[model samples]
Target: MSQPNPSTTPFKAEQTFLAYNQTQAKAYVHGRPDYDRKLYDAVLQYHTSTNGQTDTVVDLGCGPGNVARALAPHFTHALGLDPSPGMVESARAQGGVSATSEPIRYELSTAEDFGCHLSPPVADHSVDLIVAANAAHWFDMDRFWATAARVLKPGGSVIVWTTGELRCHPDMPNCAAIQTALDHMQNTELMPYFNPGNILVRTRYAGLVLPWQLETPVPEFDQKTFVHRNWDVGEGFDNELPEVDLDRYETIMDTASMVTRWREAHPEKVGTEEDYVRRCRRTIERLLNEAGVEKGQEKIKGVMQGAMLILKRV
Candidate 1:
């Protein structure tokens, strides 16, 4: 994967997604997969074991509050911060709150400017946990780490995780062929429109530039406490999920940032944004039919390989 130019502004790379409207935000809410419950359980357990408390958690770049709401039950207060007003609105609309769950608050602020905008200014060393789910790839890591180091309490945990490369199970007939078609569409048709941040996800987050190092001393976090793990779902790995039908799969594809960019750039190719989606759906359906997979009857089991990074504050 090619690296973005060093001088490219973060906004330039993320403007499309950040400028999400109601329709786009709704698509994301419906399409994106929820994090496996076991992943949350394990992370919370680690936080408890390491810090002995789960007081507050700040979720940066929290798109639609998926991670924040899912993990809110394990903490006292869960604050989701994002620069996108549409995402914040969508998250607020979803509104998952219960007696056991931390009350979720969605704030419109960039990760780099988060602390300064807080009502009480997120006092130094006060946050017990910080997380960035699939949204971290777009962050300015150096600035984020600096903010994290300032807000996190001693032994507080920072968890960053992202999913990569959707894969279909090989057992299904013509699954490989269907996957090939989809891959061609994504890699060949939509590749140019993909933002620079996508490289981090394509590498399963191994390409992320972390401030702390495991083999060497670092200032922001404890090198000894760093942990990296990969969960391969539905591929003889942990957290296997149910098969996804064609409709669900299409919805997921619609949430791709590349698709959005493509629609904006090639309005002449497709009549409208909705027509572009219909065209892609038709393409997928035709591929599936060619593979002898019945549209509504047959479902495709797939795996989403995800990487998790956990580090404790110094």
Candidate 2:
């Protein structure tokens, strides 16, 4: 089954990662937290329930191939695709492999075209599952769904998910004040860097186009087979960072793509007093200090709220 969209509309802004250098790519890999096993379990359960195979899986927009690596152990062939050459290199360097120890392949491609655009194009209807993790907002959904329909075998699955807003844990010292500081950074300092992709994620994917919701609608996927799931704080997939010093806190915040863009647009402000991350660090440090969590480790705890959308090919 497949779906198609006519006269597709796309997001206005391109991702900053597409221009990443090796240094930036490594930093991105370092900053990102690996998703939990539970989330993978959920995906697998949903995929297999519809009689989807564990033969070949393709990860689109796979940065550093994190999601691809996670699911690789279950499939015979695990292919990760991203448009960024740097990201592809990083993913390859990270060592991809399947459950049988067969090396996974990471290629330079975009979600809009994926594996089918390589030197040797992937055969049509050869893929068993296609997934994107926190990366779909940057896609031209109409094109992506069309390509997905072309590559996916009948009864295959498409699972896309993202971690959304950060919620400071109540147990953290001066949690409310810390939350306020975090909000200030996002709503103020990083406001100008907000792109359509960021807005989609922040809104819990409200604006993300679904397989069946395209302008022309894809008949291969049925709306009845769609499943939406929300995970609150403590769900593990929210990517909680429990108690961290100022350095760790800043590093984690800097990992955000929005923050990366903010730094790029204001390189002069980076590491200077005007730096958004520096200001947020100071505010959080002050609040933690006021709570007696002086210049040390694990001063606060927070979680990323998340949402998942599952679609089964008919």
Best by TM-score: 2
Number of the top lDDT candidate: 2
Q: After superposition, how far is residue 303 of candidate 1 from its true place, in Å?
A: 1.5
With a 3 Å backbone cut-off (N, CA, C), the pairs that clash in candidate 2 are 2-220, 3-218, 4-218, 243-298, 244-298
Q: Runs in model 1 with CA error above 4 Å?
A: 1-13, 98-102, 213-218, 235-241, 268-280, 295-298
Model 2, range 169-252, lDDT digits (tens) per residue?
898889998898788767766777777787778877766888777777888887897888987766768343565556766777
lDDT of each: 0.75, 0.81
Q: What are the RMSD figures for all models against the true structure?
A: 3.5, 4.4
Q: Which 10-residue span in candidate 1 carries the lowest summed lDDT?
A: 4-13
lDDT of 1: 0.75
Looking at model 1, residue 51 earns an lDDT score of 59
93, model 2: CA deviation in Å? 0.6
Stretches of candidate 2 off by over 4 Å are 1-10, 238-241
lDDT by residue for model 1 over 1-314, one digit each (tens)? Answer: 35564224353337876999767888898888777777788778888888545778888888799888877776777788888889989988887653355458888888877757768677788888888888778877767777788888888898888888778777656777767876776666678886667767877777666766323334968777788888775433234355777677667777878777887787776555355556556665676677787776656667678888898887
Measured with C-alpha atoms, the lDDT of residue 259 in candidate 1 is 73
Going through the candidates in the order shown, the clash numbers are: 0, 5
